[model samples]
Target: MKFFIRTFGCQMNLNESEIMAGLLINDGFEWTENPDEADIIIINSCSVREKAENKMYGAIGGYGKLKEKNKNLIIGIGGCSAEKERDALLDRFKKIDFVFGTRNVIDISNLVKRAMKGERFADFSDKLNEVNYSIPKRPFSKHHAWITIIYGCNKYCTYCIVPYTRGFEKSRPIDDIINEVEEYNKNGFKEITFLGQNVDSYGKDFGDKKPKLDLLIQKSAQFDSIKRIWFMTSYPSDITDSLIDTIAKEKKAAKYIHLPVQSGSNRILKSMNRRYTKEQFIDLVYKIQKEIPEVTISSDIITGFPSETEKDFEETVDLIKKCRFERINIAEYSPREGTVAHKYFEDNVPKHIKNKRLQYIMNLQKKINLEENEKYLGKTLSIIQEGKAGKNNTYMGRTINNKLIIFQSQEKLNGSFLKVKVNKVSPGPLYGEIIEIINNI
Candidate 1:
């Protein structure tokens, strides 16, 4: 049998899809890139943004048409959006044969078995039945892999749906995570990222001897084969001194921090239940910069929240100018069902206004990106080789601080690390000349 999986949303969703692919491959199924040629079609979707949700529905409809030509084709929906809709998803998407929630990824093989037998199934239970770490996976990058250090989120930010869809914080055992990293290293993978919804709160759910994130980084650094360690999406209030210290002191750990500050206005932040104030967030960014002046700080920002006024929008703009973030992911707020903000707060912000605010923030960030990239002109940057960027021998890679650089080079450096001298700077990517290979990936 052949299966094809289309993934949407965050890195966690991508990871989950990869796991699903692994399970299918182990069940003696081959993967097909084209849905029309596959026996099964799976959509791993996200519901954080209304745009993503609409995409899911549109994809289902398109796949339904494809199913008409192939009578035996089985269609499945999984992840946040599927979990949110639950059993109702089957009713809404009449062509779908099965639905699996985020927590149901462990039983995917069994679900597929039942699905193949013509038994319709919808598993929305909130059980965290995780598969073993040794499962075969089709990793996105041969040299880099993601280790889910923890699962789910506890902070029920009013505007967020991850807490309800993915459930509460469930930290994986440190030994298990370590073993996974070690295995990746042994398999010739040079980079390993520790991932969690809130990585800073990794060991908090467990007993007193809860292993610290710093310890995990330190132990992973001791691995002989691995060259890079990265992590992401730290809650502002959960970041600790030790975490900053580890990143600053450890050579293997990348010097990039992804701490999201949803909004800049204190009133709007409170409305979103973000827990930290704008002043506190600024202070935290300052602290991170103080510890590691060369750190590349990235952030997530949402515009046009419920009751967001022009003054609140101006505050966000002012905050961006003050902090000068290296990179910013801006999103226009859309009320999701079952979230506190959805239930209590009115979606009073006009769509046009929301779009205008989003564009304003993104435009500002583009200038910042250009200015920031300009600073690296004539400086040497260490970059890992990503695949080809375009035709004419154009290749791409990212610096340690997470800046993508496109350069002209004849050498094939797919997974290798090389130092490049920055020649030109633009808003989109850095142009550089390869100098020498640092580590052959």
Candidate 2:
């Protein structure tokens, strides 16, 4: 049997797809790059935004058509959207053979086996506390891999569907995570990113015996083969001095933080159920910068929420100006079903206004990015070469701070460390020429 998996949404979803692929491969199924050539197909989905759900629906429609040519092809849906839609997906899309929830990834082999026997199934059972500590993973990237140290979210942000789709926060034991990191290290993986909906909330469920995100990073740093350690999507108030200190003290820890402040307006923040105020968020950013001076900070911003006034938008603009974020992912608010914002608030923000605000923030962030990139001009920086850029002899890589750099190279230097001197800078990426290849750090 041949299988193809299409992944959507965040890093967690991608990692789950990899795990599913590994499981299928171990169960005597061949992996196929083309959907038409596969005996089985799975759509790993996301429901964080309505747009994401729409894309998943469109993909389902397209893939459903493939069944006409091959009636025996088994179609499966997994991840957040599948978890949200459940059996309803099978009812709506008659071509779908099976559906599984976010927590049912480990049972994929069985799901496929059952589907092959002409038995339809929808496994939405709660397996939040179950930990697959040593499941094999076929990572898409050879040099870097995502390791889930924690699962789900408890924040219940008013505008997010994550809490409903992913269930409550459950953390993996530190020793198990470290063992996985060691496996990746032994297999020549250079970078390992610890993933979670709210990485800062890791180990909070364990009461007094809680092992914090800092401790997890500390343990992963013990692997000598791992060149970079990173984590993401931190809750603002949950960030501690210890976590900041760990990033600063650990030589392998990447100097990049993806701390999302959804909005800068106090009213919007409260409406969105974000626990931190604008003042508190600014203080946290400055603190992180003070400790890790070379750190690059990125954020997420919503353009127009329900009843968001011009003053609220201006406040967000002011916050961006003050913080000078190196990168900002700006999105126009789209109310999702089952979220507090959708249930309690009116989606009255005009589409044009929302788009206008989003564009303005995008332009502002591009300017800020250019300013940040300018600081590296004429400076030699270390980069882990990612791969070829397909233009002449150009190769692409990222600095320790997660800034993208495109440099000229004569050799395929993927997974190698090299020093590059930035000759030019753009809002998008740095342009440089390779200086010297470092054999070891």
Candidate 3:
């Protein structure tokens, strides 16, 4: 059988899709790049934003036309959106043959088998504290992979659908995570990003007396083959001094930190159920910079929320100016179903105003990014050659700070690190020429 999986949403969703693909391969299935050639089509979805859900519906509708040509093709929907409305989605999506939730993803093979036998299978969000087990052995690139450290969230941020759809926080046993990393390292994977809904809150569910994130990072660093360690989606409230200390101290840990400050306005933050204040977020940023000078800070910003006043918007603008984030993912607020923000706040922010606010944020960020890139001029930085950039012979790679660097090179140098001296800078990327090969190890 042939299968094609389309993934949406955050890194966690991507990791789940990888696991699902691995499971399918083990079940005597081949992966097809084209959806039309597949016996099974799975839409791994996301519901964090209404836009994501709309995209899924559109994709499903398009796939429905394909099903018309091949009636035997099995359609499956999994991940956050599927978990949010399982049986209802199955009923609405009559052509969908199988539906599985986030918790039951590892059961893809069993579900496919049952669906093949004419059974309409659906499993939504798992009950709280439930555990599903399967060790999926999926094929991966020899250079990089992702290892999930934890699942779900307890934060219940007002704007997020994760808590309702994915349930509360659950940390994978430390040994399990370490073993996975070891296996990847042994297989020649050079980089691993620890994934979670809220990575900083990892050990809280296990009743560990101390923070487990530090121990997990420290343990992963011990693997000699692991060249770079990175993790994401850190909640400010859960970030600790020890975690910063570890990242600063560990040689293997990537010098890039993505700590999301959803909003800078205290009122908007409280309304969004983000426990920390603007000052606290700034303090954390300062601490990370002080302790880890090479650390590149990235953030997420919501431009307009319900009832956001001019002052509130200005506060967010000021925060951006103050923080000077290395990269900013700016989004206009879109109220999601089952989220606290949707229930309590009116979605009254005018579309034009919200967009203008977003543009303002982006414009400021662009200026900051240009200024930061200027510092790299005449400096030699190590980069892993990702391959030719765009359609030209310009090779593309990234610095350890996760900054994108593009340079012209006649030689093919993919999957190896090169030392490049920056000769020029663009608004979006650094332009450099390779001076020498750094390390083949």
What would the per-residue lDDT of candidate 1 be over residues 1-441, giving only the tens digit for each residue?
A: 999999999888888888889888988999889888999999999999889999999999999998889988899999999989989989887889999998878677788888899988798765464555777787878888887778889889999999988888888888888888888988988888888889878998788834388889999999878988889778999888988899899988888889899889999999888898999999989898889858888889998899999999898898898888888888889889999999999999999999999999888999988998899999998888878899999999987778889998654678888899999999879999999887544
Which whole-number lDDT from 0 to 100 does residue 2 have in model 1? 95
Better of 1 and 3 by lDDT: 1
Which 10-residue window in model 3 sums to the lowest lDDT?
125-134
Worst 10 residues of 2 by lDDT: 125-134
The top-ranked prediction according to lDDT is 2
Q: How do the residues 1-441 of candidate 2 rate in per-residue lDDT, one tens digit apiece?
A: 999999999999988988999888887899999999989999999998888899999989999999999999999999999988889999999999999999878889988999999998898876555556578678888889998877888889999999889988888877788888889989989998989998888898888744498988898888888989989878888898999999999988999999899788999999999998999999999999999969989999998899999999999999999898879888899989889999999999899999999999999888989988999999999999988887888889998899899988865588899999999999999999989999988
Best model per TM-score: 2
TM-score of each: 0.97, 0.97, 0.95
Q: What number of backbone clashes does candidate 3 have, counting pairs of residues 3 or more apart or in separate chains?
A: 0
Model 3 scores a TM of: 0.95
For every candidate structure, what is the RMSD over all alpha carbons to the true structure, in angstroms?
A: 1.6, 1.3, 2.0
lDDT of 3 by residue, 1-441 (tens): 999999999888888888889888987899888999988899999998888999999988988889889988899999899988888887898889888888877778888888888888796635324332346656444566777778888888888899988877788888878888888878777788888888988888776545588888899988887888888878888889989889888888888888899888999999888999999999888888889867889999987789988899999988888888999998899999888888888999999999999998888899999998899889999888776687668788887778888988654467677888899986688988889986655
* Cα lDDT, all candidates: 0.87, 0.89, 0.84
Question: Could you give me the TM-score of model 1 versus the true structure?
Answer: 0.97
| Candidate 1: segments with Cα more than 4 A from true spot | 126-129, 209-211, 439-441
Q: What TM-score does model 2 achieve against the real structure?
A: 0.97
